[model samples]
Target: MNSIPWSISPSTRGWRYAIAVSTVVLVGLFLAQGADLVSEDNEMLLYLGTLVFAALYLGRGPTRAATVTSLFILNVGHIHPGFRIGFHKFQYVISFGIFLVLSEQIARLADNVRREAWQSEELYLFTQECARLTSPQKVLELLCQHARRYCGLELFASLAQIKGAPLQTPRGIYGWVTPAVQGNLLLDSLQAQTALALERIVQSERSRQASVLEATQKLQSTLINSISHDLQTPISSIRGSVDTLKTCELPDQDRQVLLDLASDQIARLQKLVQNILNLSKIEAGGLILCLRWISVEEMVAGVVEGFPAPARARIRWQVAEEIPEVQADFSLLSQLLSNLLDNALKFSQGPVAVEVSAGLNSVRLSVSDQGFGVAPTEREKIFERFYRGQTPRHVPGTGLGLNICLGIAELHHATLRVEALEPGSRFVLEMPRKQEVTHV
Candidate 1:
């Protein structure tokens, strides 16, 4: 709607043509006074009608010109004594001239109002777009387009580390352009204000993101330091006791019990240290998968065979006999499978079930538990570290197992999904048939 072309001239070509035609009409009316078109007693009324036409079409200056010319032609051309140039006639012209100036001033004032309203509307839309934007160059492009809506403009953007300094563009990236090539300098001033505002906003937002990343990194470091320090004492004690037990003489039953307790404690301590260490590795982005071309059949068999004796009755496997070779780190794969199976055995009420499918050069493994199925709303939440489910507190488990398994699977380029079945819940691991090099 604002595309009304508010340019150097508010008067249109149509208005110019109308004014010319109106002037000719006024002149003709005077020349036609001999045809009884011009009146004697109604002279005031005739001039008043012409004055209204002047206000309607030609505005102030033209209105006053029309008045004076009409008066002169009425006396000279009409030869009417009443239309003569007298003191009263001059007074009427002066009054009519004032009215024309007042009308002109009103038109100019209204035009200013419309222009300001249009600028406000454009500014509002530009602000909304700016609110959702972050990247400096993208914002600059938008700024140029915003100006283009009002009129065409050029744009350039730059990023600086500090206030008012030139930016260091890596890989030949430039940040700034001049508006001179495509648009008015007025638009440049508008863009400069926009850039300055965006600069402030971008600075504030960048500072916020930087602060969050810094805090997270700091927390991770603190946890790693604390965990490392905490493990030293128990680890040393466990190693010392293990060595002493090798040489000490004791009864067979007592030695057996001591050995069992020692082994269990050692396993518990090892699990805690390892969980934190794996988390630390992931946080630092130092995780590497030592992929080796290995058979999925062997991987499945190894995981089943490695299960604890206490859960032997709960174990079930339907691994594919002709599983294809998959590239994976054996140790990490073993750990992931171990964690998934361990979780199933711990939470499941009836016997746990394992199903392995091989197809189209890919493999998928699913572990199902007959215990309570996870609620739909909590499914995603269960994958986060240290998240305990709705299970009773007495259950002997740490929440880190599933989270670690997910992290390890991701590192190996595999996908993990949890689905709720009618009688149980299932954990599925999927790996692509072919691998490709990663790109940044």
Candidate 2:
């Protein structure tokens, strides 16, 4: 059932058949000369074997030539009254006819087996390729390519109905081909494989959409819960302070204390609201950068001065000498550093150190705090929105600070990361020394 081992041109095939037949005939003649060796019947069998070889290896034209040559040589050289075409008896004529019939039948059977094997091989390869493709359009394109290569047919898809026997699947009619290719078995098999590949692609897309939907729902729920808890606490504190001032008479000093407490709670509420608004603007792709050249020392000083005197006294900062200026959105960069400093002050009792240093191609700003350092496993998770690690419940935070800082760093094409220190943790932001600012 295997095909001919190799393909040959028509001229080359003729030469091979001639050489093979000549060899067989010469060997037959030698044996025939020895009267005791090959009888006339045995000589006929030798030529018959030559016909079988031609059919299996040399193809239809060669096989037919071999059959006719065998018949002619047997009649003239091996039959009675040798070296003449006349038959000695009617039985000899019938024997020659039967030999011709058997040779033709063998050739026909071999051709059928070879054709079926070839079809099976083509189908197997086509199915294997389709199984690996995830795009339905790609599968369809491959189907057209295969049709053109193997069947000499030009195939194309159309949404409208067309005449002739189009290749139709359950989805709809795929395309039509020339009359010669309408019922080709290989084409039909390719169409079926394409249909299955398209179905698989659709199923995969549906599964991906379902996964994204589930994740979005979970994110929405977490945001709502975090916002509600963070909002209620500051509002309640501000309300209680006001009610006490209005309802009870108090010394001026005590009233002033209550007023400061109310102001502090109001500031906390404003910060929380601002963080939420910034996060919304970032996620909605509305945060625009106003880039300008600014000195690192001045930027650090400005952010430190914005904090309360008590908090600022606990902060120690240094700028490496000769550090060049960087182009960045001043306010956004200031907000990023402020968040890091605030977190440091809230958690650490000892002084927080801010160091600004420059590298060959980048500028590095790091804030280190002497507080409970972030655990190795929780370092990355700490940057996720609304994610708070094992901080005690009494610490008031919305967990949006680090996430917003990350967003700001990304907008300016910078890298932000955390390093655990011996007594606390260090948050580092590295920015390219020179950058082209483009609207995000």
Best by TM-score: 2
TM-score of each: 0.65, 0.77
Across 1-440, the per-residue lDDT of candidate 1 in tens digits comes to 23533221344545644563466456546646554655654654565566555545444445555555555655554544544554445655675466456545643554455455666666666666766776666666776666565654434444533232122232232234443343354454455545555665656887999999998797667556545554665567677667767888878886776676566557657666677677778767877777678777788788777554557668888876777788877777787787888788878768888888887866898888887788998888888765767967656555677888889877767789899988779999997656643211
Candidate models: Cα lDDT each: 0.65, 0.80
TM-score of 2: 0.77
lDDT of 2 by residue, 297-416 (tens): 999999998776678899999999999999898888998998999899988899999999999989999999999899999999999988889887777677889999999999889999
lDDT score of residue 419 within candidate 2: 99
Error of 2 at 81 (Å): 8.5
Best by lDDT: 2
